[model samples]
Target: MSLPLIGTLKLRGRLTLYVTLLAVAPLIISTWVGANTTRQMMQDQVHEMLRIEAEGLKDLVEASLVERETSVRSWAEDSLVREALLTGSYEQSDAVLSRLQLRYTTFTGLVLFTESGRAVSASTPALRDSFLGQDEAVRNAPWFKAAQEGHFTSATLTQEDPVFGMQVLHLAAPVMESRGGRRLGVLLAAYDWGQVGEVVKAALERARSRKNESFALEVRTASGTLLFDSRGQDAWHVPNAVAAEAINGPEIADVGDGWRFVALSDPEEVYATVNKLRAGTLVGVLAVVVLAALAAFLLARGITLPIARLNRVVRRIVQEGDLTQKLEVRSKDEVGELAESFIQMVDNLRETTESLQRGTRVLTETVAELTRAAEQQESNITRQAAALQQTQVTAQEIKQTSMVAAERAGAVLQVASRAEELGRGGALALTESMSGIQTLRDQVDEMADQIGRLNERAQRIGGITQTVKGLADRSNMLALNAAIEAVRSGEHGKGFAIVAKEIRTLANQSIQSTAQVGDLLEDITQAILKTVELSEQGQVRMEAGLAQARTSGDSMRALSTIVQDNMNAVRQIANAVSQQNAGIAEIFNAMTDLSTMMHDTMVGLQASQRVTEALREVATQMQQVARSYRV
Candidate 1:
């Protein structure tokens, strides 16, 4: 369906495809933007968590240092240092140093200098050996001099050392008499400043400062002597301008690195603040994104489901060629009307096609009937022609027979005339003979004239018979020519062609029958010849009879004039009887010739009718064959 629709664009709607594309474009754009937003928000959330974690550990380290300092200060006020200094015994001093060293790892050296600036009891063997020696640091150190004033302490810091090496927190206090308040030597306690340095390095890790973001430390005594400081060329600084704000007090500050910044000092406080913002923002964004996604899913489902169903219906109709399928769209919209119209159109087209087929069938039937009738008529004509030809043959035979009879009658009549002449001569001689002779002579004269007329009549009948025979022959020839022409015409002239074949048969029959007529005519000619010979012979016999009649007439005229008159009366009766007999025979022969001609004509017509009838049948058959060619 999709491929065929691409082939024919007319079925496609004007705005349907465009509107779908329009809807899809925005959906795609919205999905992309939403994904990007969610990604940015998640990254922000992760970074904030790392920063807050860094700030949290920073505060814990600071608090640990403060507690350490307070614990160490209170420990120094014990009577252990005064006792150690008063005894100064080798074993006793070592005992106190060892005892105090066991209390803490921050201590490096604890020494007591004399009023003359001499070192006294020490915490370690090496430092004890160096005591009472004039070392500038041991003799002129801030702690050494500060002990003259009593109870002055230095902050924990990085500082140089002479007796036991570098130190951190150094505190000094004057020892007074138990009874009168007299001062013993000053008590000096040196702390390892490296311990404080460890605190600062620890702070850097806890603060989450980069390896390049460094830290610095410094300390000053009350007399203005610099006591401890964490300053070295190798030190990695806690580098930041925002650290200046932290320097004012113990509070959090924003430290600016070139690319970014962070607040520290209150490690937990910064963590709590930034993390609160991060968790809230993440949850809010998540809620919004989830809501949006759910709404989009629901919306897409709602819109696309209807469209998909519509597409399915369209595909089914197009693919299957089933116009009966209609849209099931519940909405009363344009698409619904379109489906209805399509169904209606298909129904109308089917009905119209059926009606057209019916009309064509009726028209075909009418033409077939008319064609059959024409062929039947032609067949009838051919049959009639055959019959007509038979009749013509009969007529020709009759005409020839009549001619022979007429010829014989005429010869008899001529012989009768000669007898009449001989009869008049016979009447002069004998009376009895003369009476018969006169009758014979009168009959001969009348017979002679009648015979002459009969001969003429025979000739006429013969001429008429020949003419009718010629006409019949011509008609037969014409029928044969027509048949030959039809055979030459091939299948196209098959109707006429069969008619021609029938005509040929009719012609052949007519020809044969005519030949029979010719044979009968030949027989009639022989009979005529026989009649002429017979008539001549009859003439001779009649002549002999006429002479006898003449002698008799002579006798009658001589012997009795009255008898001669009676003989004259007998002659008149003989003349009338002989003449009537000859004339009647001639008329009968003429009638016979006419009957033969008529029969021949009838036969010719019948033959033609037979041929024509056969032709009509052939025409009807041809029409039927032609009808077979139609679908």
Candidate 2:
């Protein structure tokens, strides 16, 4: 949808809008999409890394529990512990328990309890004072039931212990008979929960600082009791409401029995990076839009300024009727070519106008000179009429001289024969000249055909040049992609990188060569254009010359008629001299009138032909100027 403001904006705004549509919008969309994709990918990678670390921590905790279970089972089967529990012999059992405690220092305390929850022996003397028989809490404990069921159980319990203050895990193993396999008592070992927490914490720490975000480490029981939280926000080792909220979000790994390693992920730190990327993208997008808008404005200015100048020049010419205005060609681009063409058009028009003016002046002078000569001929004919009247009176007086008249008639007949020979020769010359003109016309047509063929070849060359350019561009793109892949391959792709570089260089050279070929084609096209134009002009001139030659042939036919008329007049003069001298004056007057009329007609025909040729040239030049514009 377009905004209302868009319609109201000028050329600059339109250009800016087009630029944004063409350049900026796609950039923003691609950048945003790429950033989001990267963020999702990175988030998935972080989750995978955290899960792997969690699994490792789970294995460590399980190994710790397994080792404690092994030690407890071995002690539970010992004869000293069984004797202490069954026979109430604490001296030997305590000695053995002390030795066990010394070997595994992580066991804060150890105890031997009977099947009925009575304390048999203790590893620590201080904890022994508090050991109770018939205690409900001890008998009801989950680990106690697990031990009676002949299974090793690790149970996390929070208490204020002297050695390991906040929380401890009790590892229990059941003691049984060697032969009958009867239950005897339970052996218990207190492993500080802090040791297990250190393992979990270490695994998390190794992964936490690597990427994405910071997270809290937590150890919980299957019953949703939070045992150890690295956050240290809950020092009492109590179940936290906030921490429970994250039970669904946190990733969990089972340590053993019911205990779990939970990592409560906090993504704020990781998303902070995504936020920064988004901010930078917005900033860069804004920068690109600003730059694009600025370029659009400058581009609009460049185009409009030239158009305005051209319009002003055209308007001036239209108003003033001046064909002398010319535009300055500032660049070698389309606008410059348009200006150059317009200048040429105006120059051609001016030259044609000047030629017409000169032709008109010469025609006027020719008409004036012809009128004066005709007036002089009319005067000479009037004097010859007066002479004919006197000659008639004199000839009537010479009617008696028949012999002289007959001699003059014989001489007149000889003159008539000579004139007939000259007329026949002139007619043959006219026929030969017409044949030469026809040959010239044929040659002109053949030249036009050859020039047309050259134009076609030029077009073919242009297409070939374009094909080469496309191939070069494609090769360059392929080389660039190859270089990118080589760089991605790092040290292994050094040889390929060298090959790609050479390919790119060759592609560039090919592109340059194609461009040079294209320039040559343009030159050829221009030369062909000029040749065709010259041929057309020559054809036009040849046609005009043919027309003039035909006109001359008609004049020659008329001259032949005049020559026949002169011969008839000479015969009439001889007849008048021989028969009646009275008719001689009339024949002489008729000859003088015919001569004056023919002279005037010849002068008018010559002037008309000259004017026609001049007008034809003007029209041809105007057409050439008009052809320069394509549309």
Looking at candidate 2, the ten consecutive residues that score lowest on lDDT are 241-250
**Candidate 2 stretches greater than 4 Å from native:** 152-165, 204-213, 234-259, 271-278, 306-631
Residue 609's C-alpha lDDT in candidate 2? 53
Provide TM-scores for the models: 0.27, 0.45
lDDT of 1 by residue, 1-631 (tens): 3856655642233133444445555654665566557656644653454445334323433344344444434444446655655666445655666677778677776665556666666677677677654755555766666557653435333345555656545666676656666676665666565664565555456445542233333323333344333445554333322221122123532111111112323233333444565566657665655555555556555555555666676576456544455555554555555556655765664455455456556655655665566567556655765665565566556555655555555555555544554555444335555456556656656666666666666666666666766776776677667767767887776687677667667656766666676666566666656666666676677678768766655555555555445456555655665566566556555656655665565576566556556555555565454332222
**Maximum-lDDT candidate:** 2
lDDT of each prediction vs. the true structure? 0.54, 0.72
* lDDT tens digits by residue: candidate 2, 1-631: 4678788986656876787678788898899899989899867765665566555655666677677777788888998777776777788888888888888888887888887887768887766667654456667887788788767454536554443355667777887877788888888888777776567666556656665235556666677676777667644332421121222222332225556666545566546677888889889999998898788778877876776788888888766665655677787778778888888887777776666655656655665665566667656656765665565555545543655677878698778969877886787798789899899889889989998998998899899989988998999999999999999999998899999999999999999999999999899999989998998998899899889889888888888888888888887777766655445545555555655665566566556656655655655565444443322
- Name the lDDT of candidate 1: 0.54
Candidate 2 Cα lDDT to native: 0.72
